[model samples]
Target: MNVTTILLIFLLGAVLTYVSGNKLASKIALGFSIMAALASFYLLQLYLANQNISFNGVWLQSPKVFLSLQADGISLAMVLLTTCLMPVIVLSSFGNIYNNAKSFYSLVLFMAFAMTGTFLATDGLVYYVFWELALIPIYFIALIWGNGSIESRKKAILKFFIYTLAGSLFMLIAFAYLYTKTGSFLWNDLVKLNLTSTEQTWIFLAFFLAYAIKIPIIPFHTWQAKVYQKAPTVGTMLLSGIMLKMGLYSVIRWQLPLAPLAAKTYMPYVLALSIAGVIYGSIVALKQKDLKKLLAYSSLAHVGLIAAGCYTLTQDGLSGAIAQMIAHGFVIVGLFFAAEVIYRRYDSYKIKDLGGIRSQTPKFSSLFLLLVLASVALPGTYNFVGEFTVLFSLYQINIWYAVFGGTTIILGAYYMLKMFQNVMLGETNTKAFADVNWTETFVFVVIIAFLLLYGLYPKPITDLVTPSVKEILTIINR
Candidate 1:
């Protein structure tokens, strides 16, 4: 039940999956991911009971960095996220085919391993190590197995790789500076330093550069659409479903807590940028004819508000951001999977050709419409709960911020509903269509059920995340 065990399971599972050979690879990966997820829930229960599901060892004596993996309330939430989405991600691929099945599935498990370590690492160096470790498997996954013309995919993936890698370097610099200040890379030690306002500002920007590129708040988001369009459905799922949360989670876990003064000083500008991303992504999504690209912009808009909420530095804001992260993770995966299903049948992503699918496949259309409504933050859905709380937090700081941020509700509905109309509701497609098979049904059912259950009763999650959010707020307000 230790955090170390959780990491080991995913890593071991990944290696075993690679060795499982082609026939058994996907099953091994799926089984391993599910086992890890259920085990994570057990560990989460232990964590909630105040058990010590943590491990630490001296990995580098000279640098004084520890290979520490600890699960707290916050980390537990994130670890659970990484585990929960992983199985569904794997299951979503059960019906698809790839040239090198073993390599592709192994990469998925490896990506989960990296992401799990990222959430569980307590040492700054280890966290950074895990952070970059995540990029490797995904790079190959997209580069080797991704979709689109070979040349076009190559350009898209390289831009994505370079953009994120370049941003990560700035974060490395900041962490290096932090180690110099504290003589240690431990979270506890780093949090105790009394740095000057200027130093904090620099550190804040260093972290901001990395996170902004990932959460991809305006101007810094150019890499996303092309990458999403080019990558395979599974790669796109990994990116939007969970990888984006790495940045949003870091904002709560590292940035604001470490550089409170800088965060406060720069709040106005950050809000403007984040809110601008909200409007910009929404408007662009409104015009996108390509389904995958449209979903990417939609993700950008949703996460922009999540980033804005984190910057608010309030209990409601931070906690709401975490909830939204979970909600968006599920909703986006389902949406992208829906896009993939449509693409499989038509071999095209252009919205114009996707017409009157509802007339043919009522079951898929109904399911898709439900997910679309959830995405638009319809009442009684988890997204609505997250969105409302975040907007309320924004209103506490500035009424106008909430007003502009609120446009997502209106514009989000406009685009998602319009896309639904175009893709699922128009003229009946000329090609015969197949609805969700058992595996796809399992994926959608899990997503729909969780969103509904949580949407109706968010108190459990709110309670779980509140203490951690409040602790971070205490550091920020100090």
Candidate 2:
């Protein structure tokens, strides 16, 4: 009934999952995630009905940073995303034999706890704590359970850890500066500061460095390809599906409103960079022969458009970003799970080593192609709604900008279809590629159902988040 209930569910579930012996750990975690997700949905229903579902308490009295958590329409949307995806992500691991199943599933639940907290925390200091708290479990997850040679895995993990932590330092410094001006770490106080243009510009850049690295926009994305390739499928899912949105969501909630003038001032250059990432990621995806790496670049392309939409600073643009974030979360999890399926059957992830899977595993091929179409933003799929709205918002800004941003559709189709043909539609590989089992089928069914259902009628989600989006816009315009 309260926001704290959701966080408590995940946190307590994490401990209980660890304690539950290896034989039942995965199931326990999966059950916990499903319960939490269902609970979060009910809470979102209450929030939309204008009922208050919040928790506020003092953790520190001197400076008065409260252990406050609350949900308006926007935070619930993100919380729903984190909750919904955790169950699916946990479900995907049911067949695999992890070395330390208890620890692995426990970290998965713990990460969910931190992410939900990040989405719900209204106090700036509490939000930052959850933000940095997320990095801990994922770092170990990748380092301990990830696939690759020790040297390669260590290098990738270290680079990712150092890169992201460095970004957090800048965010912390910006928060410290803002606290001096307002004497409080509440979001309400920060947005109300009458900062001069110089202060706004500097603070904007500070937050920009933090979020951009997390979102992994073009120039800052050096860590993405390597990390994604080296990580296990679950780690990749966490990084791509939910964690990346943390950055995009932060921009809407914190960066833009707190530094409105600078946000407007720097949007042009930022849009150009974001659009550049769209092009860059697509072009690179075309050349990638490794399945995981190809999807990595593809993710980069799609997320670039999401980032560009955020900078468009329009109602259509911001709402479209949220839709795309949720849509992308599901589609990417499906795609990565598909890749894992291919690997398990064929023992290889290289495109050259894969062919004619469709001939043998017709069921998987059918589902995968649908997911591929969704990724390319085909109409009647959820991504199409988000992508079209985003480009339309850019068109309102400038026709040339829209034209450039729109290349993702064509380029995405080219690379996605090309990968599909090369891997799924050749002469049958001289090896077995069995169709997906029941659990895998269940995973794909859940993902596809969400896409099609929302694709047919997106009004519910759009209506739910619009008020919150407008409130952020109102603060920015002030």
Candidate 3:
């Protein structure tokens, strides 16, 4: 099957889930998500066998846009991240019931469809369309189903929507400008233009603005913590786990190759900004009293490092960024699920209200400890492989870069450990904390196993991503 099949599966699953009614929506959504995962793995098999898994067709006559979906190791890795995590995201919600379950579940699958299309689309216009499509579902999901007072949640979600939308328009203008220059928006065509340094700089900043707001790098990240706290856990998972990677992926896929000189010219400043974000996010996370917000800031720190790796413009940096994207996706989901597990029993997310859970729920505490350890990038976890490689690349560029970037690990460990201590440990509380049920245990097991397995042996991921990273680097340096 071609890559289009995977997109169709999600789209179809979304439609079917919505019509299935509340009773079956969750089950149907979970089933379709698993099917999409299987389809993606099969697609990977085809890719490994040297088969073309891409789809190309004409979608419009006037603009001459082709419905192009390209698959390479890099894109497939991202696709796997989206599809695989989808089931986990859906399953993670089984413990909590929502009003309008069908609509909620449907939006979840629809967001997956858009994100998958974003990863696979090769035409600039097609990619932009998919990117914008993703925002719609999350908007409704957060606005209608999110936590907190109605007015506050509305304010947070609205600010996020406007910021992202405005930034995306800049990217659209960039793509439109590039289309005029190249007479095409295909990936191959856009990458071939030899624009003036001035042209490249403008184009680069436009795309950077789009990705930066989405990635929410540094100053652009104001909306993140509040929104992450306000959104439902599943919405947060989709945002943190898979959605954040889109901007990082776009940096490598669209930004650098299209404006290599701009990338080179700005690399130092970009790296500095990214490292600044790492330090800033980590420090901010240290003071967060809410569990989800703390995790949100921590996500900012981790992704800052990943963005730094991307701008390093080296093979190790690019590959490590992708690895960390995948690693962070799973680990963050598990971490958020841990918060949800607590909320399930205690009806709260405040660190002040939580404690003594380690004594009451040994299974949950042990699993959460593993997740926290993974978050801190413990030596034997998947995060370590990604973090180490990214930092090592920074060290090669400048020891100071590594020194500043390394704060993520040190500062990260401090905040994470402290948060864990306050939330999961301490004297037993009067309120009894229940152990994780089968669904929660299954989710934790899957995430931890993947992290440990890949942490110990990252060769498969390394091999898969290396060739693609090399190609992108060559394009950047050409």
Candidate 4:
């Protein structure tokens, strides 16, 4: 089968899961997610076998936007990340009971469907449609299913929705302008346009506004922590684990090659802004008392580094960004799940309220500690490999950039270790914090296994994305 089949699986899954009724919705969703993951692996095999897995066809005549879904190494890697995490994300929700299980699970699958299409779409208009479509599911998921003060949650999610939608308009306008110059909206055609430096700058900034808000680079990141704090744990997982990558991925996939001159011209300034975010997010994370908010800020910091790597426009930088993207996706999910586990038993996320979890639940504390160390980029963990490569790429560009970005390692260690100690160590908590159940253990094991496996032997991932990254870099430097 072709790659479009993967999207069909998720779309069909969303419908079937909803019709299965509440009692069976979660099970059906999990089964479908697993099936999708298997299908993705099959796609991976086809990719390795040098099969043609992409789809391209005419969809509209008025604007000449083709229904193009191209599967390359870079896109396949991202697709794999989305599909594999779908099952883990679905399974992670089994512990909590929601009011409308069917709708919640269905939205989860629908979001996956949209996001998968976003990664695969090769036509500019088609990509934007999937991009916008992805936002809709999360809006309802967080707004309807989220927790906290009703007024505050609504405020946060709405601000996020409006703010991002506004940014996307600029990208739409930029695409419209490009369409005027070139009659086609296909990626190959768009990248071949020889725009002036001035034109490239505006186009770059247009795309930057859209990506930065989604990536939420400093000055634009106000919406993230609040939304993360308010959303349900599973919603939080989906946002931090997968949605954020969309912006970062777009930077590599669309922004750079499409505006190579601007990328080069503004390299220093953007790199500075990204590295600044690294420090900013880390320090903010350091002061956070809420577990989810802390993890949210930590995500902001980590993605800043990933964005920095992308802007470096080097093979190492692009490849490292992808590696880190995958690593952060899994690690962050595990960390958030650990927070949910603690909240499940202790009914709290405040660092002040949690202590001595290790004394009560050894298995959970061990897994939580591993996740914490992974966040801090301790060697032998997947995070360390990704972070180091990103830093190395920064170093090649400017030592100062590397120096500033490297603070994530130190600051990350300080904040994460401190959080772990406050939340998991110290006096035995009086609350009866049960160890993780089989499902929880399964999720943790799956994530940790991937992290450890890839951390030590990263050649598979690096190799998979290298050729695509090289090709993209060629277009950017052409």
Candidate 5:
């Protein structure tokens, strides 16, 4: 797990930020993100050099449990994603947040640490702890600094916290049952214990309930829209861009392989729900006047497709699902940041309140246009590659599913272009508006570059993930 390196870096960042006071907190957080990035790079190099790494002794060994920390290829990929996004997220929020900067930045770093631990933790108990820990900092960040009416923000955060926690309780029970059967909390130990089909069914449902609420397929998504709408832009970015992936990742890492027969038995209903989310989310997004709310619903729709892809149980589907997860993370963050730029300038998120932005803020308009194209899966954008691969894979499962799911692109384009036309190119609404400043320009440029670069050269990511995806498929097929 490289526990020493991971924990040392995380603790050092938290302590330094806490003691440095608020004025320098942002700097400290940025510095820590850079350090984490470098460390992640070094860890990747080490993994490449060694191909295997582990640190295991005994943190706790009791009659019913043994705690261990472990990392594998999938965990490492998630760690890299977390570390890579931290600096960017910090930088994106820099000029945007002013009051109590120290607490804000410190919470950001702590959240990163918790998320990293959640991915790397090998023990079920440790995973659950980190899972809940990751939610705390974001809760306060949103509650304290988020936009919208104070009452609404409070309601949104409370709903998000309660809904996820309720689902998590069921997951905890599932873990307790597994511990009872195996007498260990370690993942490998749990994986080795054989349970009957009925037992696996109940346990898998418990875990699925927790993750589905997080990934938030159709009926479980009532809390997500308000949370994203009320939370601060950066908080929304974190939740939509990264935190949601935790649920999808857990589905792959724990549920399917852990209870293969149950997964297969329930796959049809899961797929149905995912498809419904796709159609329903897109339809609802079309009616949203608020840009953030629109994007939130759009995200739900995209994730639904990814969830369906995951359950397809094909090599292409699994690989595409993983690729789409990363692609969506990047695209959605960039999109939300774009929304923040407009809100900052016009002081409005209402689509009707904006018009003819390209006449004044050419740079901002162009960037927004490019992102919109990417969001709708333009051929040269990263999303197109993911969408194509996902649909192609879904085709193997059922052609009707692919055909229906393909409507998302058409629906996405309808709303995305409509939003673009309304916001960027109509009657000039304001007398004058400024283009993107240096910070805004830099953020958009980086996001666009990755979108284009990965769109053209997806092979690298595909190669890095293929072996792991293949291994997962083997487990499911077993």
Candidate 6:
């Protein structure tokens, strides 16, 4: 019925998931995820009818802290993305998991709850708490159930935890500064404060450090490959698919609007860094032998383009970034799932060790190919629409920038096709390999269907995001 009611339900689901046994854990998680999705859909409908919703009260008057939850078009869209993807992620994990299934499912549900809170909280302190809170369950999930040797998993998880936490500390400092300026933690209060240029610049830099590490612009990206490589596929899916977006979302929601002059003055360099990340990530991906590592680099490249779009500071760029965020979320999940399918059958993700999978698993091959094409931004897929919008917006900023960003399409095709050819097109291996079962097929097919549906008729999503994008631009231009 309301934000708190829905969040409580997810919290309850998390508790239930933890207590449940392995046999029923997945089913319980899935059921709760489905309910969360339905509740989010209802919330979206209500927001469309009413425009906005908020719940505000003094939680600690002495410190000027408030318990505030608000939903706007932007927050609602992200909420919808979180709710929509959780069920799919839960379903995808069904066959792959066994031991500690209850803990696994509980972590997943807990992640959903944290992500929703991050999206909805309107107070800066509340938002930061949710932001950091979201990371704990994922760190453990990756550390406990990840693919590599125990030491490797531990190393990867530690790197991930440290990198994100280090960035967040700077963000915490920025929020503290803002609290001093406004004497309040409320989002509106902070936004209305007339901050000096020097103050805005410093705050922007602090926020940038946090979000850059999360969006993981090039030099800061060393932790990502190892983490993605070691984490279980479900954990990888949530990290890349949902968690990364939180950084980009914050950049839009907090950085650009709150520090408009700083954003304008520093955007060119930021855009250049993003462009560098695009090229660097693609080049690095071309050399990766491990499938998970390759996808990890590719994810970095894709998000770099989205970050570039955000810095372009145009409506089309912002909207396109949102579109690409959604597109990449689905495409990366499917790509990782495809990798998981091969890994399950062959017990190897090394490109050299796999070949001629298509001969044994035509269905799996077809699905993998489609997802790969989507990753490479083929027409008639969701990624194409997002890429096109982003590139178009970049062109308005600078033709060379657009040209550099466009090279991702070429490099992407080279690496993804190379991967497909190496894995699927050679003579059948003498070693035995199994095709994906009905469950995997169902999961892959659903993702593919949504990809195509959005590709062909992206207007609905564009329409949903447009008003918010315009609102953001209004703030920037004001």
Give the per-residue lDDT of model 3 (tens digit) for 348-464. Answer: 999999899888878888999999999999999999999999999999999999999999999999999999999988867779987788999999999999999999999988888
Tens digits of per-residue lDDT for model 2, 157-270: 899889999998998899989988888888888899989999999999999998999998979999999888888899999999999999999999999999999999999999
lDDT of each: 0.90, 0.91, 0.94, 0.93, 0.84, 0.89
lDDT of 2: 0.91
Order by lDDT, highest first: 3, 4, 2, 1, 6, 5
Per-prediction TM-score: 0.99, 0.99, 0.99, 0.99, 0.96, 0.98
Q: Of 4 and 6, which scores higher on lDDT?
A: 4
Minimum summed lDDT over a 10-residue window in model 5 is located at: 60-69
What residue runs in model 5 are displaced by over 4 Å at the alpha carbon?
1-4, 63-67
Residue-level error in angstroms, candidate 2, position 96:
0.6
lDDT for residue 235 in candidate 1, whole number 0-100: 93
What RMSD, rounded to one decimal, does every model reach? Answer: 0.8, 0.8, 0.6, 0.7, 1.6, 1.3
User: 4 or 5: which has the higher lDDT?
Assistant: 4
Clashes of each: 1, 0, 0, 0, 0, 0
* lDDT, candidate 4, 193-238, per-residue tens: 9999999999999999999999879888999999999999898988
Clashing residue pairs in candidate 3 (N, C-alpha, C atoms within 3 angstroms):
none
Q: Give me the overall lDDT of model 5.
A: 0.84
Candidate 2 C-alpha error for residue 292, in Å: 0.4
Candidate 4, backbone clash total: 0
Q: For candidate 5, lDDT tens digit of each residue in 94-114?
A: 767568777777787888888
